[model samples]
Target: MARAAKKDAGNDTISLIPDDPNVPRPRLHKLIIKNFRAIGAQPVVIELDEIVVLVGPNNSGKSSILRAYDLVMKQGSNEGKLETEDFPNGIVDNAALPEIELQTIVFDKAPGDRWIGATEDGEMLIREKWTWSSPNVQPKRQGFDVQKGDWDDQVPWGAPAVANSRRPLPHRIEAFASPEIQASEISNLLMGILKDRIKTHKTGGEGQEKSDYDQLMESISNLQKNVVESTKAEIDVVEGQVSALLEKVFPKYRIKLDAKPEVDPEKTYTPFKASADLLMGPQDGYFSKVSQQGSGARRTLLWTALKFVSETKTPNDGGTRPHVLLLDEPEICLHPSAIREARTVLYDLPKTKTWQVMITTHSPVFIDLSRDNTTIVRVERAQDNAIHGVTLYRPNRSKLDDDDKRNLKALNVCDPYVNEFFFGGRVVIVEGDTEYTAFSLVRDLFPEKYRDLHVIRARGKGIIATIAKILNQFSSSYAILHDSDQPETDKGDKNPAWGMNSGILSAVNSASDSSAIRLVACIENFEAAMFEKAATSDKPYNALVRIRDDEALQTKVCGLLDALLDSNLPVPDGCIRWNALEQLEAGVAK
Candidate 1:
């Protein structure tokens, strides 16, 4: 998981808007799950955010929150205790009953009827209670505000309890579901302002002919008054100039208000399908092709549409301009070159009031290549299944001292990269960094083998200790890859170490497969081969290798590095092979 390369970690750009005493807070900023699946007999509560990301194993119930949202929207309330149809795939079979209740805690924000449209000055607060029985969850008015004060001190706009008692929050799932649907797909997720663009260049429609006729008549009446009072020559000359100016201003849309170009009667115009990507794309037709495509293509197309819409200005709605937005799993489908360009597109849009968006992925390319890091998320499923949850770690204010900054002067010396991935999520410890990199990378090297790969490297205390920590947390699986060896220092044991890694994976995911994806050797020295082969030549290691060399081979690796350094080769990859041991020998003589 790549981190946010933040310039200002602690500050939020949106200052808290003041509130009125009458207005109540809006809804849903926190979640409280009770006896919900693995979340023990004791309950677990997590706060929600504007950009909340749910992440965990396949069965850890990370998707439970979304399921809960869908249910409340569908059935309408959280009353009593829930039954089968209340959740995804029915009855929470994988999780226990009675112990399977998911209570959602809601926080309050703005106020008023914030549905279709709100007057610039209106504000409303909403709170929802969800149990197993009611489809009409109460939409009580906590309070209202005039245009100004902190949320901490606000009063209700009206007698909210009495008013809400009179009118129900319209059982319209459309209010909430629409935003979800819109956000889920790229083409559907137009800038909030795009909905108003059609109004700007509006064409008359059926059933509005009488109104149109009246408007046309009014315009003609105004024109007639001008024509009768003014000199015909002056009017004609002015009209001609206006037509020419319009043509110049909008060369692509040169439809004249006063004149038409002469044309041949028998001329044929070719049907358009080629030459421009825009013609076959979202601009002219339903972007149905994108949805029909696989996930990767769809993701890329989503990003493409966002980039296209953002570059072209959409009309303003009310006082705000509509922003077209698209988000693709930036690290996934597209080529690296495309990802870099797409990141630029994403960065440029959000600064405008017209757009706001976020993208996600697990690739390292983005971290190294990005110009900025305002948004990024790391997701991990815990090793044990007992209490499943996801951690959303951002580069916000942390109490890092000067020593911390000094320790991270180089990427090589920094703490393990996956430290944050396991931050709020479950921890699955492995042998070392090599195993971490190897487990994830090797699958790609041999795609025919692994299905879904998740790996983390625990720095010390061996795989057994890591597994032990995990076993105490969740029901996880493990996969240990080690070699056959005699008891060198009484620190080696095959079964215990193997169980450790496998146990952690199984425990956290709560998966049935509790065994390790273990690999053991009969009589070979695995570390020896690994060290000599995957030669990661840091300065000290390479320096030793140079001393071991007979001056000739030492000159070779040095020459290669120097030459590449001149051409801007990355340092992380300057040296990664076996000459270092040879250099160590020459150093011994010195």
Candidate 2:
């Protein structure tokens, strides 16, 4: 109160204000790969979101994309050496050189801003090219060039000397998998954590008063000094004799020993070089080496450790730089629940640490279709066997109707099998669980037809149209089977199946090409139709259950279905309409 009374009439006080909120941070914007591994001469441009998920069949170039990106952004060591097998088709003769280009956008001033010169469009371009000595020889990196240009600019330019300069960014890019989890890796991680903590405390001035760290450092110094002194004393005892012998052999020459421990406290004491062992086991039990741990346990530990390291800030003199994690098949060897947990961690990484995450996965457990920030890139080979670029699909909640959005959310929450749709080549959508079960049982009968086909349960006639729309968006070839549920003329308008039929018809009519889509309406419900054709009994569920659980029953059911399918007569009692079976067969034949 007394100080307030002394306020001057003409105030000259200045207020502490923060920087402009409009300032944008630097981030990796896109990646372009050309003629690299499975990728063809055409450049595949992939826009990077906070979290990028690459999903495709095996050998479809998903891993190649990750490896290419890793090659560009990797630092500290050159561990990725291009081999002969890395060439497309394992052939390099008369082939185009492999190229990888990275696009980075900066919105604000950064310490390493000088390392990257902005293009006319205000973006940085880093390009790497590789060439092989011959078709049979392995490919070697030709040059890494950085320039200022638009990301999509196809013009070629001469290499710049700046490409050989050191990277100014303070970040680390690492790949995590079962094979990368080793004792040395664990030790290095521990050392990084310890160094970060120590730096944090020292910077905050909280540990200055505590002499424990200082005392430890002093002890280390003394130990190093003692070792050097003892070694030098031992060397001195032999120095005279050795020098005399050397002088006698050569009068103008003399030899002397210099025994000194060339020790760098910081590097020599790092966890990687230091003799540090981690023993882990149950309490009150004899401990075992970490190497002896089970695969699952080791995986869990590695995951936990990575999660911690990724979230923690690495102490640096320069400002913190952005980090991007490249994970290839993180679901490998993990339990189903653990895979889901991993998904959660990946989803949270951007928010928690502002880090970018890229994952390649074949498991549905790793995908959450409802997430907004996540971008799913579908990588597939072209019909001509040429490497095709990835198709990026970002789930926009605004584009979906409220009802459709709710349905999608429910599917994510209740149906774990929904992800299989993304991985399958063709989809067979049926109404309810009974149809799904029956189709699954008969699927093996047509191995060629159903080799890459995935059967999904729509649970109701109302949802069949929704499923069809979703599948269509994925560019998936699909067949829909449902009951006609025809009612009396007076009540036909009120039948639920009628509405479903209309919806299905509407979707089909709106399609640009409907050749890939097939629809069949059963004359009656699934059970009624199956019971009418039952060879042994009228109980449809029992018959289907037997077919699913008993190999003998499955053989019998297959035989009956095949016989009925082969017959020319109208099979009104068949589980599936005769017309539907004919249409399915015709579609498969095509």
Candidate 3:
């Protein structure tokens, strides 16, 4: 596993180094795209992790990032050719040519030709440029010149040579979102596994097994030669006729039919050359081809095949290629239950140390903030009509202790909607159900003004700090509103609830330096501050009923809503620092 760190020169490039030298597996660290479709002239830098989940609305460039990665890493798929539409805004001029830079951490023990230019931390920077002054052009690799401090665009390497030099280069498997699954697709996946097995059949095997495998390959080649020789007499008849017809036309040239057999058994005897039909039926009944079933069944079959590959594929054991799985919307066509299972499979695929997973999803079920080595990036089209990606959550910046981690996990399990804020713009974190219900009603009153506003119910005071720390880690500006719990209990008391008030305020201050943070609290509790007395039970119900009947309370709640929703509105009796709460208590206690 690797960790992200800033360069000493303070550039925007993110450098990755392994946390432990013993765990040396090649992995992608970061990707930068410029002048690509959906992404404009301004570069969009995405920091990769073991499991990266990209979430956003439709056409927000999430799929573009995944496709760009596939285009660069995987060879012979369109052969790195770029169409006019691939350029930004469908313009294909020199300035609009697309370019992508990939930064990868390659361990010395990994099985590949280690390229020359590598940083001291063992990170390799490879640049891919589409040097097209016209349409349908090919891309080239630009190696970085450490001495010149620039890219050597004229690196004398073709795409195939570059791909071959890095033998067993991370085997990339793409499962882009699709409604229908063809039998050919399944055959291709199975053939990939079979091809890999055949390639490594003799590795670490007994001497007799290795000799048998070599003899098998040799026998296949001999059979091909024998077949060609057996067919030569029959082919000579056609060749004679063709040559005679050619002599009648020109009398100077002759034609011959040359039949050459493919000698490679891996190519001649793979699953791709045959028809693959998947049948599904009850144990005691007749089976039908899966193509006859609905899209859901086919999609489920595809997912099962992917899970199979992830589990049964060769592990990255210093002699095999590592795998990169670029999946787009694994949740598509899946039932809610199946989607959850898919999420787990995609997440756990990388744990085997053989595969790394990247996916674009619209489901919050795929986003988990508590997991290490997981990154959640929110991709969207900005107001300027360019795509922008913001990493809304990463584990390293959480600053969470063990207690916080336990509390965060408990919150994640208990609250099904805790991850919804990643899809919203401006967020408001409330302590419990009371403020969530009341402020939600207020937000509904003015929907357009607060279109992007999302109010998250933290469910308890203790979990507010954890949630706030996560929001702050991604530099998300948000407002925190909770009960001070002060007049009911002394602020200096040892009560944990009392302590969380200051704890929550401290989180706000830590985030306020980089992003806007506002804190507004009820003096004693929501019921007391709004209805003039604390509720014995049903606090949220009481607050909701009172606000509906009482006009004055609505006006006051609207004032608080302004502070929580609007960036310009100042919070009432807000404290930036934790200890400063006491001085502001007098103002809030009114």
Candidate 4:
């Protein structure tokens, strides 16, 4: 509102005006990692263009990635339980058992930074994956490619090929946000806004009961004081070092000055009004005095710094590009408008030739605001205690795209399609329409999997097609059996017109369809109940049929269906017999 003040530019540190308006940029190609906690040894190749979102349940460690840059700044300091290190200083119970191995790349050679640029353009969000199986972490696996045709109709100029780069004070930036994004430079920016809005005084009772202003104001004051007081000497040392560095670049500005300790909260309690010579925008009027700003404005003003920084930072002198931007729970404590506003900041920042911003958010509202190329990494834990025991998910963006192809597509795909037609969802693949319909109808037959998945019908317009569609969306193991009808080929003709090149069969064999989608066959009955002997588990389903009362057919079938198929939550007993999966779904009693 204050004419969208250029976020970090007007701040104290970066006052050095640029000689040229446009700075050169570098390419951000890939990221390499290992023993980096739950990730163990994994190389996460990030495309320079796409804006990624890291997600997962608690303990899945999605936020850790953002924290790593800080550790890197510290040169691998001893830290205990990650969450603890989240507080002040190194963690108390911290250990140095296994240090994390991490590296990143920014691809500059390719031209287009716009992921969906014209086909003539060949650059987009590409994910290169690697793994560290042992404690001896190192990068060794190939990453899966995440690309788009780079269509001309979508991105005309052909996206700019962003180069690899890092901030001038990468250490300071890391140090600022290290241990937690909540503590980074962005946090400093927020704190500045907060100090500007704090109600320092008010009419009150004679005692410490406080006049509403006392408690909150005191907390902010105390924390600010602590930071300044505790770090006085350290601040001096840093300031001295910074002064030395400045000499290397700008030797002038002969004005030697002292850095005001950040804890000098009292100084900022009063607002800095615009001088008569400098005019104020409409919103700027709100900040004429710290007392004038409403408390509600804190969320908006504090969060807007991120948006400002994005628009302010000029590209570097043709150097390597910054590969990733790790943002953790940015929506916390923000109002609906502020959250919405924050989301806009995230999406818009990467719309330019900037680095990929990978954020971890628990807000469904935020999730609803993303595009197709935004990767969603969902984390899960294991039975044993392992540092890098986290599962990563790169949601299939096709489902959302397909949904946008038409209207009926919405009814078939589900509610998620209503908002997201590209990224962030799950797919349930089965055999045919009957199976699709049956499963769709009985989908809730298994409540555990129903609420958690975005089931879509595909290919044969049946269960098998749906199965293929699901495979396209998710990366974990999934399979589907087709009612092959034992159709024998017209062997007599060398080139039989059997049309093996079409329909569900072709999709099953297409080069693009990786092993993520497995195809099996069942002849005779539509139900896959014959290939039991040679098939896999036919767990809980049999148990469902074995356990359900005569009235709850839906429950029984749904239970068996979920247990036989796959699910997010644990399958209930009536759902199916976990071990009997192969027999029921694949049509095999054995």
Top of the candidates by TM-score: 3
User: Which residue pairs collide, candidate 2?
Assistant: none
Superposed by TM-score, candidate 3 places the C-alpha of residue 61 at a distance from the truth, in angstroms, of: 1.1
Poorest 10 consecutive residues of model 3 by lDDT?
Answer: 8-17
* Winner on TM-score (3 vs 4): 3
**Residue 173 C-alpha lDDT in model 4:** 29
Give the number of the best model, judged by lDDT. 3
Candidate 1 Cα errors over 4 Å, as ranges = 1-54, 66-89, 92-127, 132-184, 191-193, 198-297, 308-332, 336-350, 353-387, 390-392, 400-590
> How does candidate 1 fare on TM-score?
0.37
Ranking, TM-score, top scorer first: 3, 2, 4, 1
- Per-prediction TM-score: 0.37, 0.61, 0.77, 0.43
List per-prediction Cα lDDT, in the order shown: 0.35, 0.57, 0.67, 0.40
TM-score of candidate 2 relative to the true fold: 0.61
TM-score of 4: 0.43
Instruction: Pick the winner on lDDT between candidates 1 and 3.
Output: 3
Runs of candidate 3 with Cα error greater than 4 angstroms are: 1-23, 74-79, 109-133, 153-279, 284-289, 309-320, 487-493, 512-515, 567-579, 584-590
Model 1, residue 34: what's the lDDT?
A: 46
- Give lDDT: candidate 4, residue 155: 22
lDDT of model 3 at position 47 = 83
